[model samples]
Target: MAEMEAALLEIIKNHAVGLTGPLTRETPVSDLGIDSFAVVEIIYEVEEKLHVEVPFNANENPFGEMKSVGDLIDALQKLAKPA
Candidate 1:
C-alpha cells in the first residue's frame, strides 16, 4: 500500500499542474485541480504501473467516490488483491 501510495503521489505530482502544497492521503483530488481528462490519464497510468485493472468506469464520474488520495488508494488496494 505504501508503495502504491508513493507511485500514486508521484503520478499526481507529475500530472497536476501548479501543485504548490504537499500531497497527503487526506488531500482531495479536487484540491489538486485536475480535470476529468487528467483523472483518466492518472487511472491509466496507475493500471499500467501497478499491473492491476481498476474496476472504475472512466467514462462515468471517475472521482465521484474518490474524494481523497486515501480513498483512491483503498479502492486500488482492494481491487488489486486476488479474489
Candidate 2:
C-alpha cells in the first residue's frame, strides 16, 4: 500500500471499534462503529495528519454512498488533489 493509504488505514483502524477482525481496504464502513461524532473526528484527523482538506457538511452525509474503506480512501484522495 502507498504511504497515504497506510496512514489512512491506521486512522480508520483506530476508530473501528465495531470491527471484530482486521481492517482492510474491503472493510465495510458500517462495521467501523462510526457515529456522527466519529465522522467529524475522523475528518479532523485526516486534515490535521494528512494535511489534506476534506470537504464535509454536517447537514449532509458524504459517506452515505460509501461501502468500504477503499471508497472512503478514494474520496479522500480526490479531495486531496489540487483542483
Best by lDDT: 2
TM-score of 2: 0.85
lDDT of each: 0.75, 0.82
Candidate 2 lDDT, 1-83, residue by residue in tens: 39989998899889888989889989888999888688678878888898778876767777778899899888777767422
- Error of model 2, residue 79, in angstroms: 1.3
Q: Candidate 2: which pairs clash?
A: none
**Whole-model lDDT for model 2 versus the true structure?**
0.82
Against the hidden true structure, what lDDT does model 1 obtain?
A: 0.75
The alpha-carbon lDDT assigned to residue 40 of candidate 2 equals 74
- lDDT per residue for candidate 1 within 1-83, as digits (tens), equals 67877987888778867567998888876788788788778777888887777776756665568888778667666765422
